[model samples]
Target: MTGMVTQARPPRRDDGSSVQIGALVPLTRPGWIEAGHHLLAGLELAASDVNDAGGIGGRPLELVVRDTAADPQKAAAAVDELARLGVAALAGEYHSVVARAAATRADALGLPFLCSSSVLDALTDQPTDWVARLSPPQSRGWRIYADFLLGAGHSRIAVAAQPSVYWAAGTRILRDYVAPRGGTVIELDMSALTPAAVCDELAAHRATALLLLVGHPEPAVPIVTAVRRDQRLAETMIGAPAGQPEFAEWAALLGDDGAAVPFLRYLPERLTPLGEQVETALRERLAAAPSFVAYEGYDTVTVLADVLRSHGTDRARIAASWPSVAVEGTRGRIQFSRTPDISVWQWAGPPVQVVDRDPAEAEPGRFRVLHTG
Candidate 1:
């Protein structure tokens, strides 16, 4: 089915009612199907747990799932459909393009929307009272990456930026952070350049580290492979901040070449007690390790449940109560940040870590924390 509405559990209360939360996920999109499944897995698990624990004032949580298809128009239409169905609040969207459009629709409809994984800094740039996010925005994530590179003593860096609003925001943040510190950032737009051409530019720059803000592995795999094969650039520290969630997929495509490459992720290398619990459940359910995206999805539902529990299931009340939310999430304590430099409704300064890929570990990414902030 393209979309489905599933209740968390059988209704147990005398009223025989359930509170509906809308989820706008990219279920059928070309590059996003796997990510969509993992995210839905997390949200389903959270809903099940909440319903099992007596639900929100005895009303079981029902998630109305819609396929956004990673398109802005589809995203808006999904929100409109959810609004017509009368959901109390809305959440779940991986693509920033879709989230931005969906959030606008949700705001206009007076429904509270929580972004699951979209990272465009502009998503929450303007003061919007209806939307909030559980993931760190692109600007904050890249700034953290810059701090990690500097801490590791890499001053000269080469940037392989893909042309997308998400990567552009990250590139701007990295440039602003590095250049002011007397560090050099050589940017190569990977949009039009061939893999061989990108390698030539990297050689010319001769930087100690390569920061790839590209969201996917199409260009990253070929570029990183070419650079690693080059004897001259073998020592360069290559990092792909945007491709962390897709690490396993990229690693399979890159083979041993993917080993030792660093990437950024919100989930720390070390899982908290709660984190371990969630991982165990996810692994048991999915028959595979959960991605950071899954953790964010779970946290998103839990946060909504929190607001609904205390402030009631009123849409306006949930939006009004978001700023004051402080729930213990799978990674750690989750809270929205209002800093001017970040997405206004974003989870401010979520701890990110630079992790290296190790082939021997059980996890596909085999992520080992190299640095944390």
Candidate 2:
């Protein structure tokens, strides 16, 4: 929990009328994309649920969505547009990149913002009430990961990856564990020009294990393929959980992994109790569904609806309710940090590290809980 502090804020009217809530985030990403949809679904359900149970101050709720493509620039633009529209607050962005952008965007415009999936621990690094993050932050998640690695006997580990915010953000987690205990760091480029160069680089580090943090579609294949083709590959290869989705495909293409690599994901079960329940509900609702982006879109709506229904149409009132609010969506507990703009500090909040999967059987639907650490 971040320290309580007062800050500048805006006032809202009490006309007992409906108001619009904005969600600026990427509607198109694998795995977590459905989170947005589930958010919306939960909100839509909450809207009806609330009205039936008696709406917030006797007024209905509405949610507006703006796609960010998980791109920071686009996210900022979306925020500007939403602010012009005069929505109550920012709610339900599942991606870290979009979440970070949401913070900056909300702060700049003095709009209240709430994050549904901004797990990047650096997001809450300052003092600002305009933005609050509902998802558990990443600090505890990193600590849990460090303990998991140490327990796994992965001492001589190497960190490798494509250049991405997710990858870049993850390096700090890896380094926290490695550098402190005298481990190796091998930065591999994901450029199309140097395929073999990537493999040789990791091998040169002479690490017993490697952790690859990759971006979309195929950036990780080259590094994995190179490692496999080379006989001198590290005995143990690991990767961030988000990068786990594509590894199975890449692993099959390379053939005969000899189990050299294990794509480790922070499992969903480890999220807050509510986060776990939300993940389960989502899987059950969209069992074997291809269009996961729908979930992301809907989830955003759900969280927004909850905030609007419970806190009236005031941005400050809604944001203030974040820390105590609950949304029964796909990822579970939606509690956020108070004055979340400075969420990066240890005082903010610690994100839950649900080990999505380990090396052996971490495929898309075949996730299993490793440890809650």
Candidate 3:
């Protein structure tokens, strides 16, 4: 909801043939308007860049956006309409529930569904052939995160997540990743508990580290707030992949240093070469669009243009090319698998930085990423 997506901008091709690309994700979330606009900006940027360089086989690329409001049923209907309209291909669906629905329908219709967001690992192995994605499976994200933390000498970890279809699935992936490695499973799924309760459990459970898995739009505020206030919790921790800036913002509301403290972020690590540059530029160029999900939408269109350009007017060919359609985007380096109808981007680690710090700084000793608890 926090991500901005753009509508169909005016075409820039001399041939006047703007290849239509369908979007099946939600466009009506709180920050979505601006996120959508940013997405559109990124898409338009991709299109203009492509056309200026080569014009996608001499035909400019275009985007066809439709809102699904994060609902699977509505997402499917949107995909159906887009398919009927005969767009060259589709992009930008974030949720796994919606992604599966759209991917299934696309498989049935032989249309290309280039999923942009959704970290649910299950979406990676879904039984569909129409999905050519640029976002990696959610489960794949955990392994990198797990390894990253473990590599950094963080083995005694704890986990938390909100209570939604998205976070529930994320909880499973995180639990699986942390448990097998002999790490503590303090509050594996925090969806059922209050943030204060989670801190109590973490303190009582004696967890040495923290890992949060968030996916729902804005449910993390209270949870992070409680964690920051509760003396039972440790300061040094990491967060899940879904909510980036939002997580930091929420934590900041709890206290000044709540957001800025170092946490091992999963998504930033996977940023592509250009994504890293764009992320840097985006931070300076535009206000941080509320949710990190916005970038998924931004990357989806960038890759869609690549596939449509390679195979002219052929959906199946474009779908098949998912595996070969390689590009560097804001989310990361994207490459979809042909055999499984899944796209997994490479992961890269970004230095942990804080956002939404309190208006004033605390004394140097007040807050730090040390384990005083």
Top TM-score prediction, candidate number: 1
After superposition, candidate 1 runs with Cα above 4 Å error: 12-16, 359-365
lDDT pick, better of 1 and 3: 1
- Local error of candidate 3 at 12, Å? 6.0
lDDT, candidates in the order shown: 0.80, 0.55, 0.57
lDDT of 3 by residue, 86-205 (tens): 887877765567777777777777777766655454553446556655555555555555655665576666667655666666556656876787654555565567666777777776
Arranged by TM-score with the best first, the candidates are: 1, 3, 2
Question: Could you tell me the lDDT of residue 326 within candidate 2?
Answer: 58
Question: TM per model?
Answer: 0.91, 0.72, 0.73
Q: How does candidate 1 score on lDDT?
A: 0.80
| Candidate 2, poorest ten consecutive residues by summed lDDT | 1-10
Q: Model 2 has how many clashing residue pairs?
A: 52
Can you tell me which runs of candidate 3 are displaced by over 4 Å?
1-17, 30-40, 51-58, 124-126, 151-156, 188-191, 214-218, 234-238, 246-257, 260-285, 288-299, 326-335, 338-373
Q: Which candidate number would show the highest lDDT if scored against the true structure?
A: 1
Question: If both were scored by lDDT, which would come out higher, candidate 1 or candidate 2?
Answer: 1
Residue range 231-346, candidate 1, lDDT tens digits:
87878888887744343566667777787777777786566787888899988877877888888888889999989999997788888897799998888888886867554477
lDDT tens digits by residue: candidate 2, 29-144: 54244444544444444344445544455555555667666677777887888888888887666678667877887877878776655567666446665666544455555556
Off by over 4 Å in 2: 1-17, 28-59, 164-166, 191-193, 246-306, 323-364
